[model samples]
Target: MLGSSDPQNARPASLDAIDLSMLAELERNGRLTNAALAARVGIAESTCTQRLRSLRDRGVIRGFRADIDPAALGLTLQALITVRLGTHGREQIRGFEQRVRSLPSVLTAFHVAGADDYLLHVAVESAAALRELVLEHLTTHPHVRHVETQLVFEVLEGSGMVPREPVHPPHV
Candidate 1:
């Protein structure tokens, strides 16, 4: 709820470009202290703290998180599986989504608007394990009409879309 979506009700007049700059710095390095963030964004430490509080109040600043490495955690194999459902109705889509989400290997499932109605990002131990995942999980589902898997030979980037960058403050 970072400021209301309603344009008229959004950020207060006192909140300006400097506050936004603080937010941007936090986005790049979530673990940065208020003092550190203040220095980087060239604001007073107390002002940085207050601005951060305002951002939090508005719901702009969500909880901080550590980025976990899946590969290091022994999740080696990753693939993108495009699933074509037998029917594209809303109920069917919801049912399929719930079931697909329940699978252990299915990291993310996106209902796309192209040739495939659903795109699944999965990670497993090996190629054989991937085949088993496709067989035991995806194909067995009732609404699943066609399942196409593109084995990720090498990951230029690992599974799932990177989050969009936080909007930067406009130049003064």
Candidate 2:
């Protein structure tokens, strides 16, 4: 479900103003009831419910999740790890992703097109735990060739509305 918006689950041609407004409101507060969302968007409750269902069915809205605090879970240390793989074969990449996904400390992993093959966001208890994670898990892995860990001093997160229009214009 991670890449639900891929070609297999393509969305409608374009999202209308109402759809964009619903997304903006949901981005602010995912727990809003149908009545509340309808009131805010100036739509009937039934219409709001129908639109929400349509969004979900179209894969525009994947799923709702709670914002969990790493600090509350005693995971105070945060790090971004840049990983370069030794091999670019599909099997190797799939195996590496599967292995990393099982690690509890790893919050998110992005397969990127850059100098590094993948970027991992991890949260641990301390520097020692981070060292263990990198040494025992990442570097020791067969496919991983190089790993770089950068400590995160602070994480500034936002829940603003997603842009209705693309920042960059399409090529002529």
Candidate 3:
């Protein structure tokens, strides 16, 4: 599920050195069976299950997702849009998130601190789509003050770059 939580999914303990071995094993292959994970962690399968559950419940383990290629989906254009807000208020942020989330081309939306108040990762089929997304949809939103976008030239996928398990960092 995209946003489901179970009490059993909680972290064991972060203070105690995370089983580096377990992490390394998971890093190598996220889909390792529970039995295999237990064996790699040198613990009983039940113990492994309990620890994994605890890790999940404590918000350590988030969820699993597949990384797909956008180009394969006919979305060849990728752009990063920097958005400036007309006003800094809780309501404005919520409005921005609501509008941004409704757009199909937005892959990710981030509220950042600095020159821009928000950053959006968008993928589209063509320059026209990009223009519609930035000029028509994003800029015209009620809370949006100014917007700037840059095309992406490359994307990287590899080890140490992607997380094996799911984790949601606290949203500001």
TM-score of 2: 0.88
- TM values, all candidates: 0.72, 0.88, 0.77
Q: lDDT for every model? A: 0.79, 0.89, 0.78
Residues 6-108 of candidate 1: C-alpha lDDT, one tens digit per residue: 6656664344668667766776778999889989889899988888887777666656888665577677988999999998788988898898878988877
> Which residue pairs collide, candidate 1?
1-58, 2-58
The most accurate candidate by TM-score is: 2
- Each model's number of backbone clashes? 2, 0, 14
What are the runs in model 1 whose C-alpha is more than 4 Å off?
1-16, 57-59, 154-172
Task: Report the candidate with higher TM-score, 2 versus 3.
Answer: 2
Model 3 misplaced regions, further than 4 Å: 1-15, 18-20, 158-172
Error of 1 at 113 (Å): 1.0
Candidate with the greatest lDDT versus the true structure: 2
List, residue by residue over 1-172, the lDDT tens digit for candidate 3: 2224443453344523335456557667779899999987789998788877765665555655666789999999999999999888898889888989999999988878798998999999999999988878988888888999899999765667334455779899
Q: Estimate the lDDT of model 1.
A: 0.79
